[model samples]
Target: MNKPPRKKNPTFGIAIFIVVAVLLVIATLFYNAITEKREFDRQNAPEPTISSDAAAAAATTAKPASGAAQ
Candidate 1:
């Protein structure tokens, strides 16, 4: 029987690998840049304030949800 042709060159796979690696590097750098900017903004932000009554309400509702999950 005649043998069908298979992938003879590994260059295509190597090129794909290089492209993916470059894309990943770009993504990592972009993510890091955004996080650094966010950190800077967070540090400069003013202290947040919330009502004690609302906080207590949230805390009370949280316990029953946890118990019901059991």
Candidate 2:
């Protein structure tokens, strides 16, 4: 069995490497844009943000009312 002659071009490998690198950079940018858009939408969604201090104060004040009712 005779194998086909291989083409000898050292630059061919470099060309392929450059193409792959560009593709990877484009893919990364695309992925980052999509993730950022999703995050932006999530921030704009109708979810309420509560502070930890306000939550703790509410819990402490409610405890005495519940105990008095019992």
Candidate 3:
């Protein structure tokens, strides 16, 4: 039985390697950026200014539906 002739160019393997290498590099950079951003946000996120007392008062004073029968 005769086997099929193989193509000479090794470009398929080289292309696959290059794509994987680029993907790994991009993934590393993206992960690093996301982690840094998350950490920075965690450290710098704003604190709510409303006091607990004011929040409680507002909740208690909130009105019901205006169209509802009393």
1-70, model 1: which lDDT tens digit per residue?
Answer: 9989886799999999999999999999999999999999999997655786678778778455555856
What ordering of candidates by TM-score runs from best to worst? 3, 1, 2
Q: Give the poorly placed runs of model 3, Cα more than 4 Å off.
A: 1-4, 51-53, 56-70
Show the colliding residue pairs in model 1.
none
How well does each candidate superpose onto the true structure, as a TM-score? 0.56, 0.54, 0.60
Candidate 3 per-residue lDDT, tens place, 6-41, comes to: 888899899999999999999999999999999999
Clashes of each: 0, 0, 0
Q: How does each model score on lDDT?
A: 0.87, 0.88, 0.92
Query: Rank order by lDDT, top first?
Result: 3, 2, 1
Q: Considering every candidate listed, which one attains the maximal TM-score?
A: 3
Shift in Å, residue 28, candidate 2: 0.1
lDDT of model 2 at position 43: 88
Candidate 2, 1-70: lDDT as tens digits: 9999998999999999999999999999999999999999988887555686678778778355555856
**Top candidate (lDDT):** 3
lDDT of residue 2 for candidate 2: 100
